[model samples]
Target chain A: MSSGDHTAHVHRDDYGSRMGMWLFLFTELILFGGLFLIYAVYRFMYPTEFHVAAMELDTVFGAVNTIILLTSSLTIAMSITALQRNRKTLSLVLQFATILLAISFMVNKYFEWGAKFGYGLYPGSEMLLDKPSGEILFFGLYYTMTGLHGLHVLIGIVFIGIIMYQVWIGRVHSTNYVRLESAGLYWHLVDIIWIFLFPLFYLII
Target chain B: MANGTLYMPETEPNYLDYRGRFKGILGWILSTDHKRIGLLYLYSMGLFLTVGIFFGFMMRLELIAPGKVIIEPQTYNSFFTLHGIIMIFLFIIPGLPAVFGNFFLPILIGAKDVAFPRINLLSWWLFAIGGGLAITSVFLPGGPADTGWTFYVPYSIRSTTNVLPAAFAAFILGFSSILTGINFVTTIHRLRAPGMDWFKMPLFIWSLYATAWIQVLATPIIGITLLLVAVERLFGIGLFDPALGGDPVLFQHLFWIYSHPAVYIMILPAMGVISEIIPVFARRTIFGYSFIAFSSLAIAFFGSLVWAHHMFTAGMSDTGRFVFSLLTFLVAIPSAIKVFNWIATLYKGSIQLAPPMLYALGFIFLFSIGGLTGLMQGALSINIHIHDTSFIVGHFHYVMFGGTGFGIFAALHYWLPKMYGRMYNEKRAKVGFWVLITGFNLLYFPMLVMGWLGMPRRYYDYLPEFHVYHFISTIGSWILITGLLIMAVNLILGVRRGAKATDNPWGGETLEWRIQTPPTHENFHEIPVITGGPYEYKINENGQEEKKYEEVT
Candidate 1:
């Protein structure tokens, strides 16, 4: 209802872009939260079958991807610090490291799923479908949750590559870095999802 | 002017008269100005509402006689689906907030536009694109989504229609909603003028804040849930297919987590508009403004917890039923507090029965009945009896259509003049209101009675016992449509040929009324500092009232 000084201030960044990013992250959390809820309910319903299904997933692959995503998250986090400290080249190197880790994570997922498909364990396959319905349900959650996570990792890699391009051209710099920070936050979220997914889908007994 | 060099004439170029970067329709379609975006929403929503009305008309006509009169059972199912989807997503959810909130949120908070102007424009385009996809689904190769708007699990996954595009349409619309939420929350936090603080803001902004949070937090759940349903159909995911060990109830859980609070999203803004209108028309500061404001937050919080009330008959455990039923009742407290405050504000006040005020009053009466019936359904025992019956249908209409629908109607009548700088025929507006009320009550009331008599909903035909009630309801539809035409025609004439509106049309004390009618593109030439509350009508030293708004030096 009240106004401030009538002097026209040229800086129109009344709302910091970082605030918008944080708000967007809230939505991303809820999006995965839905999947987690489905996981919880279905797991409770068929605890024995879910446990059996978890045993079939190769923990070696799950563990390796988790480590890869965790390291990528760290690199992306450090890259923001590098950019903020005005080390442009070091920032780009760290960004490259992060994308490399994301690619390895996806490549690991491909072989794991390829092996499962080799055994005819893919969703709706006769071998899995012929098993107890709980096993089908268990595999369903694993694929949907991990596949959705993979999509995010892929999107995060593209997003970081774009940010790196912006940094190289000086469009993003030490003083102007919300874009890089947003991309970092997204990468960390993808990492955190893996952190949870690794245990719930692969480690849980 | 602050520098004493600039001058503003009474006939300065209004927002409508001013042109932007693009020309012709592109200027409006692509403009980042919040006002123009608001108008874009209004025009698009109006078109969808007409289509929605036609669907409802067909359904009611088919129901006039119990059997198939114009279409078969399958077509009737699709008819209801189209009607529900169009009304719920395209109209009610976005209606008030998108149209009025966009236009006035910045102006009322004393800012030029929302925090992110380009993002605001993007949200509208998303909405239009989402709406277009949904409409296209109606005629696509598969012949529309035959699943009800709820799109309950296995059926939705198994439907032969174009479920993917239709469900994706709602999913894409969620992005539009989420972006708007981020914009509004940031705007209210950052854009308020120097003297304006959280407590000093209007009730409408407070309600929008609550609604925005739900949009931000809860909408994603439904978005992802809908995506899962689409995935199940596309791939045999069996996520919710009972035959595949998937739980159908889980789908309801995910869906209602967003939608249950979505009811508040639909109604809270309407309540805010009524809060604005009642105080202005009654010429009083709102009764317990803080209470009304806090009640909005309360409704948002508790509304989220009560989603399972909709699932009581879906075979939820007894404990879950008990907890959800109690939470549902608790949400009613805040909504009722708002109704009480509006009534208290009107007590012994200089009440003006303008068209907008009449609509607000109608909203209160209709929403109260809706709210009471909601409480009735919230009770586990009562809900079991009326579950899936016409009573549930009646209750939702009283709430969603009667409550939120009339809220939008009231807002249209109230704010159209401010946007266009012209007033509608007040006398004709009153006549329209009376007929609309009679028709609305006639339209929905029998459903409550017949619902108690065990007339099930979603049925294409009914036994002879339910015939009388069905006939009464169809007649009510005719009356309601007649009244709607009158109101629509009156408002159209007001825009085309009515006289100009003054700055302070109803002695409103908000910041928008203090500025030029219809407003300029940048809103204010220079921001004014406030020294008092938004609704105070104070007496000056001469024992007379001062200007409705004043600038502090």
Candidate 2:
């Protein structure tokens, strides 16, 4: 990352960087997209079982996590706007807020999953095994999708944390903040995938 | 290293010998030079390819006369699985794009380097790790996965072999592929030299652009699918478990969803290489430039829709089978357009059958056979017959080996001299080509024949009736290896001590030809301003010489 290291600094295009980030986000979407396809097929095959399985997932936890993620997305977006306006303090604070929200989302997820484990209702559990196969598949997808989403949240927190350090170091300021913007784009994608997952898993009838 | 007086005075050192803060091997592994990274891929891929070829050779030796030629049946199962994994993921999947694409994409488009140089290096590292994990699986507690490269479920889940590591290897390799795809797509879009419009870029760039999109979009599907498989195996996730009322057929759907389009990821860039070689060696502009370029996009787009053809015998709805079968047939049109255009480019032109052109022409011949047979298997009835036969094996090797393998050789021969500032021995390179081609056809064609005559693939033993075809195919493997050795030696010798090569050895009209023989770390002294199409060769209509377009200044 030294200026003398290589040609990465010679001709940097923020637009190109953003485009690369978007393309990467597309790959992320499709990765979860494959999981969603499986979810839909199974839900269709076992509707009543899926309905019964849906009841097991506490909507309060799902709704609380959804709102937390949505607010974090807004904070991250505002953090970029603040950076663009050269309000470094505001940007850092908003970034911290976003990171805090993401952590809360994870905390909510841990408890929700913990509750299920207490009930012995997880994948391959004896209780879940005694239930219908459709219910087994529903919880399987619920764990997989939310677990993957939670991992992304952790990664996003780390990503934003690093960007926060960069911002504090004055490396990313008003004039050069594509790194910040790219991270924001990734965080939003994480949020958007949750938007889809929440209604599909928690709100399913 | 100068070959002629027309060359300009050298300023910076060529990429090969250039040293940075990190010296020697560290310089290469840590350096972000696209050319150096390309060479890294080449050397690493070359190593893995040799390992893969050894596995293949042993398999062919095993199948030489049917019963117990070398390894036990379990060992044979592991060998074929490892062979498919190593060859497809390690060698061919990332084959042309990773090696040649990284080396030349920036240069071809008149740029200094790829869009994300660090990510480019990261991709190479990930590739090495993935390949390492795959090879290491064989030595792991259980032998390598016997579930084939497809890693079909139920068996993949039940088999106690080292499926986890193999699956993880494939998943990690998928990340490498996606990163390269992102780098290339962004580089092509944002880094094209000024005045180089989309239509004005080289056909190879066009093909890379299309291939990059597929790589980005399709590879992730495989990533998640494999992860699901691994999860099913470890945690009993039951997503693909039939015992849990999960549909195993869904795994096939998800796997092929990425994998079938992955065929395009392998071949489209090969087609791009052929497009570049054909016009350059023929000493004429490419025929139907837009058609050939558009055909690449067409192939990438339609190639995605036909994954289900692989599942025809997996009991798809009749309507689903019909749709996929039709899409498979439709996909053939764009490929045919390319083959026809290449042939027409050769027609009535003063064609130079150099080592590269020889391989390119051979690609055209072999890919056509591979492709047409593919259409045969696309038919629902025919697919039922040849679904798991040696014919399926023959069909892929012909296309994958004959098509992409030759394309890689052609690119190496065509570009390596420029990369190394030395020419390979023409006679030896040609001799290598002839031996390789003859051995290639002899090795694979019989598999196609025996497959038609009911020879099942992946079998350690076969019926006596299929013995002759297997025997002939096994001998073909020997010839093929000899030819490969000849080519490898000749190319290596050429790189080390061959005659100094001129800047534009084959009279190529692309931007790569305009750079130094062995390009400096920064490809162009200053990026050129392009003003015309990539293949704008001079024409001699009615014996009156005429230039095609305003030259890049």
For candidate 2, the clash count comes to: 0
Q: How would you encode candidate 1's per-residue C-alpha lDDT over B1-553 as one tens digit per residue?
A: 0111121655457888876556788778878788999999999999999999999999999999877789998899999999988888999999988999999999888888888778888999999999999999999998878898999988998889888998999999999999999999988988887688788788999999999999999999999999999888888976899989888988998999999989989999999999989988777788998999999999999998999898899999999998999888898899889999999999977777888999999999999999999988988998999999999999999998889988998999888878998878889999998998899888899999999999999888999899888999999999999999999999999888787876667767778877777888777777766556777643222433323212212
Number of backbone collisions per candidate: 0, 0
Model 2 error, position A185 (Å): 0.8
The most accurate candidate by DockQ is 2
List candidate 1 stretches off by more than 4 Å: A1-15, B1-7, B10-12, B539-553
Off by over 4 Å in 2: A1-3, A7-9, B1-8, B539-553
TM-score of each: 0.95, 0.97
Q: Write the per-residue lDDT of candidate 2 for residues A99-164, one digit (tens) a residue.
A: 999999988888888988997878889998888789888888988899899999999999999999
Ten contiguous residues with the weakest lDDT in model 1 chain B: B544-553
What's model 2's overall lDDT? 0.90
Real contacts retained, model 2: 0.68
DockQ, candidate no. 2 = 0.67
lDDT of 1 by residue, A59-137 (tens): 9999888889889999999999999999999999999999999999999999999999997888788898887877888
User: CA lDDT of B232 in candidate 1?
Assistant: 85
